[model samples]
Target: MWRYCSLLAQLVMHLDTFRVSRWLKRWRPPPWPALLLRVAVYSGLWWVITEGSGSGWLGLVLALLIALCAPLNVATWPQQLRWRRLPLFIGFMLKNSLFGALIVAQLALSRRCSANTHTRTYRFRLLKGHPQQLLMANLVNLTPGTLTLRLGCDTLSIHILHYQPQIEAQLMMLESHIAALYGLDHEPWEYEY
Candidate 1:
């Protein structure tokens, strides 16, 4: 019985689906430039939270700890942010959010309702990360007509107060903007009908 159990264990370890080779692959550290950038951001946040306290070492240690703990993926790093484009993106979001609020208000107050509202399961191409995906979901919810009902591995189910086919186009544009913001691979955008 012991011999049979040992053979079973070895066979299980060698199973095709249980390949340990992937873990044996080289584990690369994040780029120095990105790491430095994260440390800076974390330091700034710490400064804000601490209200400009002079406890410098605390902030530095915290920043280093957080940066080291962050997932080591070049594509998902916050350091990829195009600082020059952030203002433009912020302006875009503000304008859209205002527009969405106004539109939703009008629909709510108008006699003819349900004219353009839609529900869709939009499949996004953005690299999957909790932070990025959560940002995308929250941004969509902030928009007037759209509310993110569910966020999946590569899909977001949204309920729009005002539905139009053109909303899909708008979402694609939003996704593209987000992709640029995060320095993610620009995968061709596709959606389920």
Candidate 2:
């Protein structure tokens, strides 16, 4: 019984050491600039929501809380984002959205509506659960006729109202733009139409 108790105590000591090391490894504090930026952005949003009301103390507390927690969840800091490429990405999305809208409008007026509707799953090149991947999914959903049905680890399932061979190319372009915005380098993958 004494030997068993000694072994159990040794195991508990090992677990405590592992837990301490793991906690230490993940305990990095947020950079000062990122924390300040988050505080400023959150405070501005609170101000807008409150319509310049004199609830300054509440806003400050809320802003601080959110700013402190933001770093824990974010994969990349806002400072690391490629701001210069954002305009070009926005333009690309807008152009594609316009074209998609035109195609949807054409399909709506035409007699054959469901003839070209299709659900295709494209293999994603971006890392799973990355912020860029989420943005890509949102942009795809924003475009007419292409709704993101499901976003998986390595695949994105989309419902296209008018299936075209070029749709995959468009998606690849959008993915590349988003990857650029995030300063990520990934090779485009081929998908069957």
Q: lDDT for model 1, on a 0 to 1 scale?
A: 0.78
Indicate the TM-score of model 2: 0.68
Encode model 2's per-residue lDDT on 1-193: one tens digit a residue.
9999999999989988778765556656677877787788888899999899849889888998877766446436546577788898789888878987887788778886665789998787654445667787889986767899998886889999777788888788777777788777554644444
lDDT, each prediction: 0.78, 0.77
Best prediction by lDDT: 1
- Clashes (N, CA, C under 3 Å) per candidate: 5, 0
TM-score of each: 0.64, 0.68
Those runs of model 2 whose alpha carbons end farther than 4 Å from true positions after fitting are 1-28, 54-58, 70-79, 112-114, 126-129, 186-193
Model 1 weakest 10-residue run by lDDT: 19-28
Candidate 2: 10-residue stretch with minimal lDDT: 184-193
lDDT of 2: 0.77
